[model samples]
Target: MKLRILITLSIMVLAFGIVSADFSLKWFYPEASNSTSSSDTFSIVNYDRMLYGATAGIYNLPDVNSVGSDPDDYLEIVLGSDELKNVEDTTDSSQGVWRCLDAEGNLEWAVGTGTDESRSSVAILDFYGSDGLPDIVSGTTSGWNVEAMDRFGNFLWTFPSPPHISGPYAWHSSPAVADIVPDISGLELAIGCNAGYDSTDNHWGMYCLQADPSDGMDDGITYSGWSDYPTAPGGTDGTDWDTIWFHPTDAPVISAPCLVDMNNDGILNVVFGTGWQGGIGGSLGQPGGKIICLNGEDGSLLWEYSTGGSYPAVSASLAAGDIDGDDDNEAVVGAYDGNMYFIDGDEDGDGTISGSEIAIYYHSGRVYSSPAIADVDGDGDYEVISGIGGGHLKCFHYEPSAATVTLEWYVDLGDSIISSAAIAGDPDDATPWLFFRGNVERTAFYSHTGDVLQIFISAMRGDNAYLYQVRGDGTVMDSVRIGEASYASPVVADIDGDCLLDLVITGANASYDSLFMIDFPGPDTIWCFGTDISIHGCETTEFHPQISNVYTEGCSLVYATVCVFDDDSNYVRGLDISNFGFLEDGTPIVPPNLEMINECPPETAKVDVVLLFDFSTSMDDEVGLMYTHVPEFISALRDVNYRIGIMVFNGCPTEIDGICNMVKTHF
Candidate 1:
């Protein structure tokens, strides 16, 4: 059948420290897959399959761990069906959302959001039905429409049966779900809607509805709140968004709603900002937006605070922390008017908060980046961090003595900041790292090389420098205190011919020489021991033999050309391949029929031969047989420097291999 199979081979020289995959694999990216990785970060799902969104349909990069992978498996399955039953929309304009079911690029299902949906990120939640599968929910940009579908692509429900198509509506605000009623059973979805440009405009505000009906019979969403719009405002005559109470906003709410217990009550509360296009309302400037906190149970306003200025629409999100010395959480948000506002949730014990309750820090340009209130320096007190449109990220804290906010530090990032900063683990226990020219890159900034996972850093202690190896598992495995302080990290390579990586750390605060080169045996799993490896009586460290060519003889017998090399990749001359191995399909081909056609054996190798045979008169037939083989035996040693002598005994000898012993003693 002539079976064609994928081949895998590896060569492991455990003693001399050389390990490599013997076969080859080439990597390639399909040009027709997608243009960019989309504005949002690429998403990974279903066992390392990466779904990259674009203006066209989604491209799934299957098996992220392999090279030369084929990513076009599902591309053909999609764009050919009208329903896009498993992958993409037939109409290219309605690209839709897709789910990669496995690493083979098979699809679970795809649902089109219609043309020009401008949908926000989809959330996978288990709030749909008793089917025991996740329900996918997504809202269109601006208050258009929102859909919740089960894992099988079956539509569960759509809000506002007659959905609003387009206007100044849903931006990038995602749907947030939380346990709204402390006494109730199920959860609720809190959506912050987009208000109009003018202050008097209505119809857009906050809506809270039961995500999954507790009755189990109801197949759609029903509002839950203190108000009775279903039985009071009209008496059982209402629509989808009418069951819950509504609170109107002055401008569009572009940020996703954040739900938490604002005042430590048992119930959840929604906190979000209201804004639109940042600073684009030039001559007739746009109305400013406000940051509001609403009771999650009833849609009642807990507290609403407006930013100072002709408040430009603040598209930035909101964050909460204890800004003041008082441990009550305050709303920290950035507005488009170039400021970070810290609004106290409950100040002055009054029903409404008006003056001295809000504090502002001028950040210079439009602040679209949300403020994060965290103890970023691990100093017991919390600091407010945010960035502005002019590319400056600043940190500030409240001072009771000065009765105002004070700036701690700021750095220019060389670009406008829109994304929020994330912190992991304890701030005091963080290890420092030099960014790939300030940040980790996909399209690398420079072609310089090392290993990104293996970090080498040097520290200055007293008058000495300590070189340390920081492993990927966040542990310091090895350390050495050099004689001088080094301002740089340790650089490693095979600096000598010993096949071990050597370190070169340049000194900065010098008490000694500027440069010190040392053998770096720290954290390296492979180490070459001793001066030279003579396992097969060959200088392997100085002359390691590797298979250079492989072929077959008579279509059955396999052959390989082995060559010896030094550290400089130059051919080590005058060496013969006495022993070598070829790994085929991870198994060595034993007893290869090797023919050393091109070899230069040592010239000084000497050979001496002594022949013993019977020359008795009773063995004339045997003596005549020896005369025929003597010429052929001498011809076989033509390539050898040898001296031959024959000893004919009068009778037969005793043992088979006694010729060498008798010649060494009596002869």
Candidate 2:
């Protein structure tokens, strides 16, 4: 047997347009000459602007200080520059640290540290000193060396690791600051360092320190000077440090620490990255990358997740945000393999949480940069943003209710974006604007639709930093650039209480890192707001009838209907099959039962019919018996006589001329 199948296909159309509303942009002062960075300033007012970035040649490092006084009268930035001397014709490209300045852009004092070995990383915190002066806390290198400095750049104290806890490598991640006071009394600071090793012969581990601001010891402060936080379980085993991998050619050790609040419980959390050093046989180790989470108060292990495979991609930096709208903060980590993971946190510390998954593009090139999250779309749901080795900015939005993630957009900056993204604006906006550095030489602004509105070029290395006034449609109303060669992210604040926002960026140059403050006039008055309404077409009815098979017996007929509706569930329109014909043994059966025949109702409505026939010979004896008996045969058709006709044939092929005329005359 052969069978034929019929298939039908339909397509739908959708329309979109800009909504109704107006937005505006305004610019204030511009801060100039910091180090290279992707950072921006936050705001308590309506006025904000971008500062100058550091030059590529100079090693001036600038750090954006914490908010002080009112949101407007806060710290702008501070930086210090140092020159690098060439050794054996090989110039040393190392990292440096600088001071943070106030909004006035005055020299608040500067300090520089690190030897020829070069500093791997630095973290700074703002605090009030016992002497009633503003003090700063900083950490660097792998030696567990943490220091506190007075506002005058004088080193007040330094904390060292215990004598029994000796390791070959130093700390890579920066220190995190927190106010442990119940309401706001005492300020406690925490710092984490990498303590583990790579080879089986030597194990590596992690260490954290809690320091007291009152004690001032500069030179050789021992662990007794500060409180010692316990390490993770099994972290002290000699095998712990042995997992470190080294590059084949460079043999660089890999580990870095990130500070965050993973549980949204108003407490700080610590996350550390561990993996084989890239550039060597880094792929040979099992569980090549691991992340351990610890409570900031006592350094107790909250949870730990390991990447179980050959050469799991690992990132040196990590950021935290609520990606799934579950109120629980999630950690965004990058990998050397260019993979990004969104590890959900268990707020209750119940040990049950979502595992890590590749949420961003994994480049074949290394991804040492960290990931940033913000609600780029003012929908209250945060979007994950990260830069790759080849300079690609990727964004993702996770809708937890649907267990689905949507790729919002991406852009290629043409250079490595080692830094993260900064998103800011009113939470009520449908689409808030975002700001980030493309490279050290240029800073660019983009709309939510991935449209590039403006590009500011600060130096040959590219604008290291940027600030913007974003409109509703994702367009940048205004933007400013700082110096070049930036690797830090921009921060937003209200430095001057004009009800607007201000920008702060950090970067380094050849020598000293300088912080600049640019103040915008007032709030941008021109606002662009959009509103949209969905519309649908309504369904109705239309008709078309055709006649077929006209003979002495009767005439056969058929009818068809068509329906059409719009996307907005409105204006529905269709057709009804009100007419039709039937066949008996390949013979046309006509309309004596025309009024008795069933009619097709509207497609949207349910339709039913019953057919009745009289097989009595007495009825067949009459010439028009079939037509007359049809009405009597079916009780439902007693009222209207739509059109009556008849037909009769007995085992003979007889062609009767004028069949319609004969039926009309008889009936």
Candidate 3:
């Protein structure tokens, strides 16, 4: 009888211990010299059973040992082993990529492809390939690069892209990937690019690429070709290229592109960021931001909206997801002016609504980083996760049925969070985590309960580092530190065959710039591929210029012509004067001879008029008005020649339609 009782007690105790160990949270802070603040943060993800992260520079040393003029340190999670390896060189700019590893840190892998020292910036990755093999794609300073390798890091085929310039001015934004075809076609890829330099000429846009598994090459080449989409209109030679359209707006530069399946269609469509004008700066001679939407397939303009008033001089980042559980996606955009916007509605995805509706707006004076979209409340709907320039993190919730968005929670970090937030763990889980970086200081984590989980700070005087990580809750995790400074986000992956998650970060230190990987041990194998979902369509609104009409006395009646240009001064179709007419206070005017404008007498017209047309598809009504008015005026003219002229305006173009000269002729 005594033995039986003892055995039963032992079994009960063992079961209790297992439950606690499996679900409890633990924090591990590696001992470091007191002088070194363990803040320069990184990220971690759990796959088969592993933890991973990257440490900037070496212990006690502030510099990394990488190759090329831009050297940096990178840590990666080894897949099949319990190990964290740091790859450093003096000549390569390889710093950003997603990493993963096994529980013992024995195996690891990273997604991103680039030259040893030139191209090394990884954006986002996932398990999207058809062969079930993990693939990786990265955006370099020059162009987009991709590669498929197994857990052993064996080279498969390398994807190719258009050759880009390689210098201070030559660079590409991060690449975003997704599985658009599900079980068959592998994954598609999207990359952001800045066509030129300088604010006026900067051409910001996105490129879509489909992955092909059959191409086998190792010479930094890609089998997937690129689509010849029209360049975004606005600015000059393509300079301040930041992101693509994810919402709706009037300006091309202000749009941000994201991938999602808003209508539950098997094909994932691209969502554009709307609101705001002129990225880093406000519009030409004006201040404030505007949002514009575009069709992902043909880069056609959709709808446009604005945030009202001149912005405080900052760029904007976008986030999207189903926020209200209404089976529709909502958009959240962050601006440097310390404001965040929430746009709701169907956004023309063939759902409950066709146009976007404003759900809410929040103002946080601090410059805002990119936003993270997730179901932070675990209510089956997503909340807006954003960081402010003042180092504050906030979450906003939306109730579609009520048409309202309310603030859920907020936390201040005492520093700016320039990077977007990354979410880990299942949404339905009891506990989930959110991760983000504090500018130049630390990487912090928060639980679903709005409690601080852990804070990782970096040592000063060494490298300005960017940190990235994955949330495994209590399972497994990983993180990595790439360089001394970073303007890009970090990526996560399971590198080795260990089934754990790893981290990849890209940035530049005082010595050089490079992409680094950090491997951590976890519990499950993580697979990732390089692909992107396409954007289905867009919605646009008529553009109304704040300063639309300018009246000048004694200007010119001679020959006047009207022309239309896009945001970048690129001429738009159907802007010809032959298709438009003018009305003076509801009075119809005759169509003037546009071909003879320069030779016509300046006094006869006396009034110089220019029309600023919104080229987005949403402006169809406005464009149609011009056509209707023009023909009516032509009929009213009666005389063949009239002293009048017209001009079209967009970004910088003074005239798109030819100059016109009109002379009154009577029988």
Candidate 4:
């Protein structure tokens, strides 16, 4: 996951910086998966994964809203299968209500409203109402419904709902928000809905709706409008929209739309795929689906490429980056056809893609995970990494000079992989590692560059789990048994302020659902809390609990931030001082501080050096003697920002390059 810095809450003390030590359990939104992230801020939003329709919750960061004030409070937007339910303020049970759009695109009472078989698709936007806070937009899979609400979960407006389709789960695609219109101030919501398989209207494709409809506090959804696929000529919704590009076989877009400036022309384009044929509960065995690129501004088709196989080419979301450092970015994605492709955005600089613009590498297994880009090998270029269903972690190298894309290395675990690889640690350091779950048996770990064989497999057998640490040279460092099975990717970070990256994994088996923090260097085990199914860590700063440098005149305070998480109850507790008093290697922090007592210099000090040289007699003896000590003198002053000035003189005046150096000048 990409770390986005969005918090500005600073706790100030007397020259003492703030440091965040341990995390507390903030709150929980039931039935929500970490799969969905909030665009409104650096917070988490969850959708219902179960077939039973429920409400979507938006848990804002601490101190973001003044309404509820408590961190545990959240906004609940009710969703149902058969009817549109009312939007409720679950934060304080305040019964606050707002207006929303019904399935027919008309303003109606949103409180206690229910709809026919709904699927929660939540996204954040800041363009809806007069309030500066972010607004929420959600869509339904069965009712083809889309609604907008304020940050407080107050209903704002809804777009005209499309015809709900009942068929395989492949027809449901989550809605994505983007500012597609050049002149629009806010963003536009784009979603793909299936028009039902057994119905006469096969209207299944991407739909675009103006996100912000608030003209003022009194006026809501000034113009409720939407445009569907297959271009409805002279429809009631509006005629100003561009042509609606439908899927080739009426397949719904299951992958999230990747909005990027693929052509490097500063204009954003939408890249998505059509798949989910055959069936929903299991493998459809569908193929030959296409990944299409369309102009964001007018929804015109920019390019379309087929998967070429009989199975769905794209069931995974597309990732875009300039893997070869070309001005144009290449769209990297995986298809059910067992091939990972890198499609050139602008091959001939014509702002369009043809069939020849794609580069493919067969992974030998279906790829359901998204691709990631990183300079894993310490090279100046990026490498593509993805997890395949056949339990293979595939890494592809991009040689920018030779323009070749080939498989660098792949590790095959003996099980299936449904989760994506979490690439973490300092990329500047050559030892970054990746962690991912490999189904029923173990979670595999690998070196970042793909050259080493250090395999740390966290294996789980029923209620018993074992954590193994193997070195690159095939040496098993340690194998400790942990209690539960975990399906989520482990997060690697310097969690305990020990300056060593630790692995934080969440247990996912039936008996256990707690988080485990494993120390890196010694593999020291630290068990804090349990029973929470999910957790997320943020880089935060707090004032150091102890260890202050006291100068004669003042004290120099140091503050450092690391990764921390709250317990399941939303309670944040401070760890004992002993837990953070030692380094990862068990080195005492006190000893290092005592040895470096005089390391800090005065804050307001400056240094200047003057060099006197004579060139009148070409005195080689004196010059050589000065030269011998020059290195030592410069080294002594290197610790400080010092300036060295030289004074040169020969006969009457030294003239060089049409200028006379008669006085000291700093260089």
Q: Name model 1 segments beyond 4 Å from true.
A: 1-87, 92-109, 130-133, 151-154, 162-168, 195-201, 214-243, 278-286, 322-327, 354-356, 398-404, 425-667
lDDT of each residue in 1-667, candidate 1, tens digit only: 1212222222222222222211111111111111123462221110100000111111222232132233433211111111111124444333233332322223434555442233343444466555555555555533245555565555566554333333233324556665675444555676656533344555456666556643534323344321322221111113343334566676656565766665665667778777655321232123547778787777778787776656566666666654555655666677777887766655554545465666777756666655555554445566665556575556678653234687877655424554343221221111111110111110001111121122233444454545444322224435555433332222222212233333333222211112333221111111111111111111224344444444443322233444444555554332222212322234443334344334222321211112233334444433333343434434442322212222334444233444324433332
What is the RMSD of candidate 1?
Answer: 24.2
lDDT of 2 by residue, 1-667 (tens): 2112221213232221111122222222232222325562222221111111121111122333333332433433333222111121223222233344555444344444332111233333335454444554454332334455554556655444221122223333344445432233345443333333444312233444333434332211122321233431122211111111111111222334455677787776666566544211332222246666766555567776554334553535566655665666666666665666556665446654443332333455556555555545444455666566666556666654444456677555545555455444431221222122221101122223321211111112253433333332234344334334444444443333333333444433222224434322222111111112111121122322211222222221211122233344332322222223334545444435333322233323311222222233333343353444333433323222211122222231122443334333443
Q: Residue 221, candidate 3: how far off, in angstroms?
A: 20
* lDDT, each prediction: 0.41, 0.37, 0.34, 0.41
Candidate 2 error regions (>4 Å): 1-76, 79-97, 100-106, 114-133, 142-144, 161-169, 179-186, 194-205, 213-268, 276-288, 308-313, 346-364, 400-403, 426-485, 494-667
Residue-pair clashes per candidate = 8, 139, 200, 41
Quote the lDDT for 334 in model 3: 65
Write down the worst ten-residue block by lDDT for model 2: 241-250
Candidate 4 structure quality by residue, lDDT tens digits, 575-656:
1111122221334323332222321123211111122233443333234433444344344433322122223334322233
lDDT string for model 3 (273-329, tens) is 322232223323123354444444434444445554345322444565666556666
Return the top candidate by TM-score: 4
Candidate 3 accuracy as TM-score = 0.45
- lDDT score for residue 307 of model 4: 79
**How displaced is residue 271 in candidate 3, in Å?**
2.2
